[model samples]
Target: MMISAATPFTLLGQNLLLLPQKAIFWEQQKALIIADVHFGKVGHFRKAGIAVPRDMEQSDLATLSDLISEYRPEKLLFLGDLFHSDMNNDWDWFILWRSQFPSLQIILIRGNHDIIADSHYQKLNIELYDELLIGPFLMLHHPLPDIQLQHASGYVFCGHIHPGVSLSGRGRQSITLPCFAFSSKQAVLPSFGKFTGKVAIRSRLTDKIFAVLKDKVIAID
Candidate 1:
């Protein structure tokens, strides 16, 4: 769970870092921030007749646990989609998880996929917000559309794209890997959920991009 300091990058006016495990380690608040965990998604698919490994939810939880224990963060922020669906047996796993780290402050920004009742999250004492302002940044579950970009108070951090970057070689080999994409007004985080799919995002020449590989995070020139 112990990780070295994240690689810092400046977006808009705030300082941020890209972590190894597809998460962001915010320096100012000493918080580990991640987006779109989509827990229990595998189960949701499997129950609908799609084949999926049942152990995925546990693995995802383990990853979060490792990050928390390593960083010993005072706060943890989930950008959205912490839960993939309505209350199900898989939700019990999440409830149990909340007990393990009793002192870690948890916050969830509700995403479109978050349809569970408020009572469930309240039981775990996880604070819920449609969006929030932390320092100079505006955190939300979904990225602002073009029309809203000009009106934003500060730089925005959001998810929902599950963004990735595509790499190609001479041998017809191509790979799309998750990435952090920064624009003038906002930054889009790669999905934190291991089971989620990614779409390669096209970036402008001035855009700052970082790709998350298995062992480390690499900048995209």
Candidate 2:
């Protein structure tokens, strides 16, 4: 019900808002879809002397909180890679953040980096699933190829590669921007974590790509 600068896009007759936060707001389902937050990444690297910023991890949580405040979504869904490592100091921060939105349902589609024991999330009332089908969308952590997608239970929404799009300017300059890449049967979301990296993807002619800018989302397909 709140206004947003996010770009509205429709898929399979369902309305979606492509957010500059590198996430999606599914209209019909009233769910906020995010991918690859990598909650403990900073702390994980710090343990190994990687020298990443200590406050960077909390900022992502703050962004999620802002989105929840604006959208008032009924559920928050993470496509995958919710945690960058097993357990770290940042986990405590996450626990504190979880306390604020105790009533909000959190669902995580287990990604490769999600190796933490289920009990940890269970105590917080966070539901974990290998894959999920809600409405016309199938939530998955890893993107599937066309061959496999043909057999998907529903139109797949995945986020593991942290998809980006390379744009070449008129002067031979090129920049890679995080993007939402949607095919006929699947859509790959960009990583929601600021500390994560993006992998530029090659899209087919018919694919739809929306690049995420600092304050808005732009359609490039």
Candidate 3:
């Protein structure tokens, strides 16, 4: 008999389920939220004669498969940059992935890098949105400015920054790794892409941050 993998914790009045990979599942919303997958990026790099690893794309998809099998989320929300560049052979792999999870709704909040033809997404049946409202949250690919905070209406969930924290020691230094950074008005997620880079972020005194570590997510005060 096979045992089901249980979802993870609840945070900030939301059910934050941490899968084995870096993806997060929101139980109440029945959505799996991931960021900056940059699928087909390796192909893009190689097309330009850059020596990036070839297996990165396949490995990325495999991780998605694992998460899907484990949580069975009704929808998969890509925060941004689903594909790195224009469509390529690697895109068919994504099309095949869409077929594998036919019943699973795929929504791409169009990020800056999503320059593929609209017809292609239409063929794949993936919904495109500049921003979305689900419950009390406004889902977007990029974060809003501080000036907009005064007029903000709801909690914002966004990606694109690929937020990480720096953790250093006497002789060893390793970043706190990718994280789900939360504040009063917004929450920023780590990039879902394996080949993407991370940026260190500074949290405010009133902010609540969750640093995603190797095994679990740790709360930082």
Q: For every model shown, what is its TM-score relative to the native structure?
A: 0.94, 0.97, 0.91
Please provide, for model 1 over 17-37, each residue's C-alpha lDDT reduced to its tens digit, 9 standing for 90 to 100.
Answer: 788788987867988889999
> lDDT for every model?
0.87, 0.93, 0.82
Each candidate: RMSD: 1.6, 1.6, 2.4
Q: What is the C-alpha local distance difference test score of candidate 2?
A: 0.93
lDDT of 3 by residue, 67-170 (tens): 78877789999987999878888998888888888778999999999999878998888999988888877888889887785576678889899888777878
The candidate that wins on lDDT is 2
lDDT-superior candidate, 1 or 3: 1
What lDDT does candidate 1 reach at residue 157?
88
TM-score, predicted candidate 3 vs. hidden true structure: 0.91
Error of 3 at 30 (Å): 1.5
In candidate 1, which residue ranges exceed 4 Å CA deviation? 1-5, 12-14
Ranking by TM-score: 2, 1, 3
Q: Report the error of model 2 at residue 154, Å.
A: 0.3
